[model samples]
Target: MRIKAAVLHASPIAKPYAETRPLRIETIELDPPGADEVLVKIAAAGLCHSDLSVINGDRPRQIPMVLGHEASAVVVETGAGVTDLVPGDHVVMSFLPTCGHCLPCAEGRAQLCAPGAAANGAGLLLSGAQRLHCDDGTDAYHHCGVSAFAEYAVISRRSMVKIDRDFPLVEAALFGCAVMTGVGTIVNTCGVRPGQSVAVVGLGGVGLSSVLGAVAAGAERVIALDLSRAKLDLALSLGATDAFLASDPDVVEAVRAATSGGVDHAVEMAGSAPAFELAYKITRRGGTTATAGLANPNARISLAPVHLVGEERVIRGSYMGSCVPARDIPRYIALNQRGRLPVEKLLSGTGPLDEINAAFDLLDQGKVVRHVITF
Candidate 1:
């Protein structure tokens, strides 16, 4: 079948993407689902910083790719031997596909499944086949095994989680990446208790989502830090107890003093080395600073060796919030339904697929939280 998708020809493109317009919307051919895959019609997809990373060259990918990993879709067809889902089932696309037999998957950490990573690195399905062919007869890679920027996609069953049929697809799209990474980092990776003081650095979609997670987790105080005032203000409206400007020279000190020492937990979501540095410096002794940011692989942070031993400070890296999609997605959604995690508040607005370039511009300026592309 033929469908429309935002296709990025190559990664590491020249900056000022607005002028270059790297992601070109094109109509292409998408094959049917394989035996281990499912065909989905996308309803909404979120514009995440990770996707921006690829466009700006911060993250590298096999190019000529359909560039979206966070999205919600309805099952249009299921491949042979598939029993868990049928047509019309609403689902969120998980960027990582779990090959249940892999070491990470067997250990209940499907996000790190080796086979999934391999598949993602190669821009192919778990079976190592490319399903999309461009008009020029070139193979288009699947971004992170999802490639959900397209109107339709064929994904491994491992890449999808069936959701309540009535759940709004726009909101469910966030759960695919931003919500899972941010909220899961606080709830699952850190095990934040009700009285713990927490700080979330950066105010992108993932960072703001962490703000909601901390509030819902009953934190004594939630300090929102960002370089943007607009985001801080939005965070305040969404239950943040305090807000700080990351650009302030005294920001780290302010966070520490406000918490009477330092926050028990600090989350770095800005995907920058500087943001991670701030998160680390503001953590109280014996506290944990969890980093979920996908910084450029070459970027490095300065960590004092003595602090690790003397202060017993835990500087842990959180990938996919150490989540088991089959378990955490439903749990988070239940909380959202109960009004404890109103992630919808993070939606800045929606745009059409053709306007994705403009949406990326807004996102690059730190002007929007979650920009949804409504199909």
Candidate 2:
């Protein structure tokens, strides 16, 4: 099948992406779904920071790739051996394709599924097949097994979670990555309980989701931090109890003074070394500092060993918010439906696929939270 998709032939493209136009919207060939796979019509896809990292060369991936992962789709066809889902079923694409039998999957840690990691790194379907081909006849790589920037995609069943048809599918795209990672990191990884104090460093789509998660978890104080004052104000409007300028030289001191030492759980979602440092510094004694940010592979942060030993501080890495997609996506969606999560407030706006480059520019400038490309 032939479809239009935003394909990145090269990375580290000069900024003002509207000018360099890193992603070329081109017609590409898509193969039929193989056994254990499903063909999906993309309903909506979100432009996430992770995708921006790839465009700016911060996060490297195989090039000439269809660059989208956070998406909601409707099943158009099911491949052999796929019985649980049928055509017309709405679904969310999980970036990691969890094989139920993998060690991590068996242990209820599907986010760390070994096969899923290998597949994503190799840019192949979980079954180890390539389904995309560029105009030049060279095979293109899948982005995190989703390649969702296109109108249609052939994905492993493992990469999809069926959703109720009644829900607004456009809003559902967020659950795939931003909502899952941001909200999951707080509720699942940080385990914020009622009356706990939480501070979220970074107010992108994911970070703002953390704010909503903290409020939903019943945190006594939800602190939001970001370099952008607009984002800070938005976070405040979304139930955050406090807001701070991350660039403020005395920001850490201010946070500590406000919380009487620091927050119970500090989450780093900015995907920067400095953000992690701030999150760590603002954690109360014996508190946890968690990071779900996908920082550049080469990026590193400095930490004091004494703090970990003396204060019993915990530093944990949260991938996909340490969530099991099959279990957590639906749970989070339920919360959104009931107005407990209120994730819909995070939507910056939506546009057509042709304006994707402009959308990326908006995201790069921190002018929007989560912009969806509607099909």
Candidate 3:
């Protein structure tokens, strides 16, 4: 089918030490799915930070790629052996999918399935081929295997998770990545218990979702921190027990005081070294500090072994919220339906597909919690 998509191809090579910008928004064609794949009519796609990472060169991706990963759509066609989904079913696209038999999947760590690495890199099916193309017959690879930036996408059955028909597809799209990562960090990784004290740095879409997740897990106090008061306000609306500006020198002290010496859990979602440092320093002895953000390649964090060893504090990284989409996406939707996860408040902007670049601008300025492209 002919589809209008934002295609990024290689530009004239940059000088040895300089950066090269990828070609943007060349319309392309998308082929129907092959066996074990499904063609989707995308209704809405969320502009995730990961997408911005590729556009700005933070994430090195292949050329001639369609850059979008967080998305929700209606199944338009199902390929052979795809029995559970059919036309009209609403679904969310997961950038990471498990083959069930892979080492990670068989070990209950589907998030790290071996195929996931290749899927994220080439955005292709397990067979190592793309289904998108240019009118001139040049193949356009998928970005993260589910390039929802286009009006239509062909994805693997393993990557598509069916959601309630009545769920808001646009909001559900956010769960495909941001919410999954944020909420899953607490619920799955930390197993936060009632009355536990928690602090989340970065109040963006993921941070706020962490706040909501902490609250849902019955944390007695959920502290939200960020440089933007706007985001802090939104965090409060989403159930943050307190909010603080990252610029405040006393931020860590204040958080420590609030949690009575230190918080039970500290989460950093800002992808900044300083934020990770703050998260680590504010956790009490034996407390857990989780890094859910995708940090830059050059970014680094330092720690004193003596202090780290003495404290017994656990510091770890979480990828894609440690989620298995087929199991977690629907559970998130159920939480939203039950009014436990207020996803609607996280949405700050929505517009047409043509405004794709504008959406990226808003994300760069930190002006929106989440932006969606609606058909």
> Each model's C-alpha lDDT?
0.91, 0.95, 0.84
Candidate 1 worst ten-residue window by lDDT: 10-19
| Candidate 1 lDDT, 1-375, residue by residue in tens | 999999999777765677778899899999999898999999999999989999988888887999899999999999987899999999998888989998889988888999999999899988798999999999999998899888999999999899999889999999999999999999989999999999999989899889999999999899999999988999999899999999999997888888988999999999999999999999999999999999999999888999989999998888888899989999999999999999999998998998898889889888889999999
* TM-score, predicted candidate 1 vs. hidden true structure: 0.98
C-alpha TM-score for every candidate? 0.98, 0.99, 0.95
Q: For model 2, which pairs clash? A: none
List the RMSD of every prediction in angstroms. Answer: 1.0, 0.6, 3.1
Error of 2 at 122 (Å): 0.5
Order of the predicted models by TM-score, top scorer first: 2, 1, 3
Please provide, for model 3 over 96-142, each residue's C-alpha lDDT reduced to its tens digit, 9 standing for 90 to 100.
86678888888887789898777766667765768988877777778
- Model 2 worst lDDT window (10 residues): 337-346
Candidate 1: C-alpha lDDT: 0.91
Candidate closest to the true structure, highest TM-score: 2
Better of 2 and 3 by TM-score: 2
In candidate 1, which residue ranges exceed 4 Å CA deviation?
Answer: none
Minimum summed lDDT over a 10-residue window in model 3 is located at 12-21
